[model samples]
Target: MSTLQNFDRRRITGPDKSLPPVYDSSPSAADPLASPEPAERAHRSPSSVRPIFLQTGLIPSASGSTYLEQSSQKLVCAVYGPRQQPKAAGAGYSDRGTLTVSLKFAPFSSSRRRAPNRDAEDRQLSLRVQAALEPAVRAETFPKAGVDVFLHVLESDGLDALVCGAVLAASTALADAGVELLGLVVGCSAAWVGGRTWLDPSEQEARGARGVMGLTCLPALGTVASVWQTGELGLEEVEQMADECRRACDELHHLAVKVLLESAKKRLGRS
Candidate 1:
């Protein structure tokens, strides 16, 4: 999968030579081609996440690829391999294949440009995504092969949303790659603020929240797979956040499945 192996990650910083940037969210941005920011987030409801757009198979050279957007945040995921397991120092034989996942942010993804290299937060988010999706993949099916998932955050609106979106995008990319899967994983997040849980908070909105949470699940199986929480929350509030996030995840799963089904039908017709 040369496309996946050679995806244009390095040029992710500037506007595409042909297309105008429609996802920039930096407050200080002055690019005339950059789309205006969405309406003030304060007007959004507490029970809803931002509306989203998802599409797959965009990278013809990759086994599978997908791009997803929710207002200001844009993420792309590419999957490669089911090929040779790289023989590294002291590598041992394995009955199950391995999955190597990395998440990186484009330098201009945030208001304050991020470093191009992976940082501590990026590593942490990568592990969280890996842990959430591993349970759904039947890795033994590939034996000595491996699958590599690469996630590029082209833009970001919030830390919680970034992680949640990464999990959602990666799982969809794996399924699109035709990997053996026990089930698909979906993610949702919320912030506890003003004595209530905000379904999905933007970075600007979450600044003063008392707590934040991110949850991932296998909606088809009705089971939660991972949970990440921060700040101090009472037991009652924690329970509420989990419940809200789970419901949101289920809703997201329905939307994701619908899109995947439609894409599959089109592919079948083309074949």
Candidate 2:
């Protein structure tokens, strides 16, 4: 046997992982990136959410595409499919189509550099996105086929907001692709900070949060698609968070509708 026969080509020579540094504001007396004081955060009310700048059909090559921005976090999603699903690997066949979501971050997306490949956080976020939008998609309409959504985080502020942004962008892209859907699914998040719930908390505000909750729903149908949360919360707190998130989802759903309508009008104008 050749001397190189046992070598695994896939392994990188050096460490292939990078992680974010623990962020602490207490030590920073003059660090410009220090977290703002409570008074400084007063600009945005507890009930208010960050302004969303969303656009659909942004990628001509994709069957559907969306670009989303909420403050410093930026995400783009491209949807392709109803294409053939791989059946050669004994993956078996399913009458219902599959919705596969992949969320990855740019190497420089966060303050700390990220790995080139999808990390655990990225995979988890992708799963959250897939779960949120799968219920809304009429997968049974296209049997033996699959729809794939790829989300890229060009930049990220808070982990909680990033997940919601990815879900929101993916859902819009699916709608833009003209996939049959029960209704548009919108995503929103809230963080329990300083003994209060704050909608759309930034990275700084969320770092010290007592809890974080992410919600996605079909607001028009008054149905929730997915709810993700972390940290200890009482039953009452959970309910309160859910109610707040749904209200925010309703607001976001209206925005999704407006974007889709405008995109359709533009397409018509072009044709």
Which candidate leads the pack in lDDT?
Answer: 1
lDDT of 2 at 217: 90
lDDT minimum window of 10 residues, candidate 2? 31-40
lDDT by residue (34-149, candidate 1, tens digit) is: 43322223668888999999999988898989999999999999999777866888888889999989999888788776876646688887898999988888999999899999
Kindly report which residue stretches of model 1 are placed more than 4 angstroms away from their true locations once superposed.
Answer: 1-41
lDDT of 1: 0.85
Candidates' TM-scores? Answer: 0.84, 0.85
Q: Which candidate tops TM-score?
A: 2
**Model 2 misplacement above 4 A:** 1-42
Clashes of 2: 0
User: Against the true structure, what is every candidate's RMSD?
Assistant: 7.8, 5.4
